[model samples]
Target: MTLTTVLLLGVAAVLVGFAKTAIGGVGSIAIAIFALVLPTKESTAAILLLLLIGDVVAVWHYRRDADLVMLRRLIPAVLPGLALGALFLAWVDDTTLRRCIGVLLLVLAAMQLLLRWRSPDTTRIGESRPAAIGTGVAAGFATMTANAAGPVMTLYLVAQGVEKRRFLGTAALFFFGVNLCKVPFSLGLGLFDGETLWRTLALAPLVLLGTWIGLHTARRLSQTRFDQAVLAATVVSALALVVR
Candidate 1:
């Protein structure tokens, strides 16, 4: 890697590490950065690997609070969506995928905003099979395409009235499973070669540092503040993706 790319990756790594704990969605910025500096397809694989590391940290921090029942409910729907996404990855054009993600984020954000307005005191809509399936499908497709699953899943979990720690735990575990499953396929696609692995190894420490900062910040905020921060960060990052 060029010095410039290394530097960029380092910076993006820290933000993503922080995002893993603070907002969850900012990892996409790292995805974008890698895609810009490296091959888009290859970067997809590398980012997934880094995200797996982040997922480990997230799960470790939030393990005791996970909502296992809800996790079980969502898995059936999420599995089919992930299969569809993996299929999409086999043929989807990079530009089309990016725009699709940008559009999806905007739509999800608007819907979430409308929902919040409709019930000012409520943080999440009632849990329903249909909603879980819908968001799970969307998240699966988006995550496979652009590593942008955070926002879609965020809306779904937040709507389910998940408490703070449980929400993070569930999200962390969900992504951990998804990304872990993705590893073999990503390698099959020739996205994770020796060079990328070496680079990721070189940058691994940044991931740890960023996660540390993010978790520390995460622990300081109230539940409401944490949720709001996640939402706000999602919206901002979504907009940034569109403009880029």
Candidate 2:
């Protein structure tokens, strides 16, 4: 890798580590960074691998607080998304894929704000079957397409009124599961090859370092502050993708 690529990956590593532990919603920035620096297919594979690293850290750190019921409900919905993502990825241009993810993030953010504003008290979005299916499908599709699943899941969890530590932990587990599950599909699509795998492996230590720092920071941030920071970062990165 060139110094520039290494530096960019370093920045992404730090943000990803922070997002996984502290905020639980910034991995997409890593996706954006890698996508910009590498081929789209390779970027997806590389980012997925890095994310899995982060996920392992998250699962280890938050294992005690996982919410199985929520994950159980969402998995069925997510399956179709995974299949669709794999199919689209085989044919879609990188530019189109990134833009689609950007638009989704923006829309999700707006919906989150609007829904909260309209009925701050209505946190669960009915907890009805329909809502669960919708959210799960959206989450799956978004995650598969861009590794941009954080915001959709974040908004859903926020609406579910998952507070603070449990919120972070649950998200950690959910994504850990999802990203791990994505590995085979990504590889099948030729996103991860011998060269990219070696490169990501070389960068593994940095991923660990970032996760450690982010996990520490996460424990320190107040719930309100963390949410705000995550939302803001998501907005900025999402906009960057849109404009790119």
Candidate 3:
């Protein structure tokens, strides 16, 4: 990798940690960064390791706060979605895959905004079985295809009106489990070569640093502001992917 690519990957690593610990959807920005600096398909795999590291920290910190019921509802649906996404990955070319990721992010962002506008109080949409299944499928596919499940899962959690800490906790555990599930698929697809593993190791420290910063920042933000920041980051990152 060139010096510039290394620098960009470092930045993305920190963003991954911050997103895991603080605002979940902000990691979409890191996804766009990785896609820009690395090969499109390879970028998804490269970032997954960093995200898994961040997940471990986030899960440990918020272990007691996760909503186990919601996780149970979502996991079964996610399996089919993962299978579909794996097939999609095998069929699509790099440019098409990149554009699909951009479109997916934009659609997820729009759905969140529309839901919030329709019910300012934010109904417990996640309680609906169909809603949970849809979110789970979308999340699985997005994560498998682009490492962009952050926004999809965020929208679902926000619709359910989960408070900030529980939101972080639930999201942390969700991604941790889902990401672990993705590893075998990624490996089967030949996404994790020696070079990617080495790069992940080199950038691991920055992820820890970002997690620390995010822990402090999360404590200070109001629930409303936290949700807003996540949505804004998702939109901005989606636009970046589409236009790039």
Question: What lDDT tens digits, residue by residue, belong to model 3 across residues 85-139?
Answer: 9999989987888888889889877977887788876666668999999989988
lDDT of 1 by residue, 139-228 (tens): 777777778888888877767667777888888888888777667767676677788788778777899899999888877989888778
Q: Better model by TM-score, 2 or 3? A: 3
- Top candidate on TM-score is 3
On a 0 to 100 scale, what is the lDDT of residue 4 in model 2? 95
- The 0-to-1 C-alpha lDDT of every candidate, in the order given, reads 0.77, 0.80, 0.90
Displacement of residue 181 (Cα, Å) in model 2 is 1.6
Better of 2 and 3 by lDDT: 3
Clashing pairs in 3: none
Q: Indicate the worst ten consecutive residues by lDDT in candidate 1.
A: 120-129
On lDDT, the candidate that comes out on top is 3
Q: What are the clash counts of all predictions, listed in order?
A: 1, 1, 0
Instruction: Report how far residue 90 has shifted in candidate 3, in Å.
Output: 0.9
1 versus 3: better lDDT goes to: 3
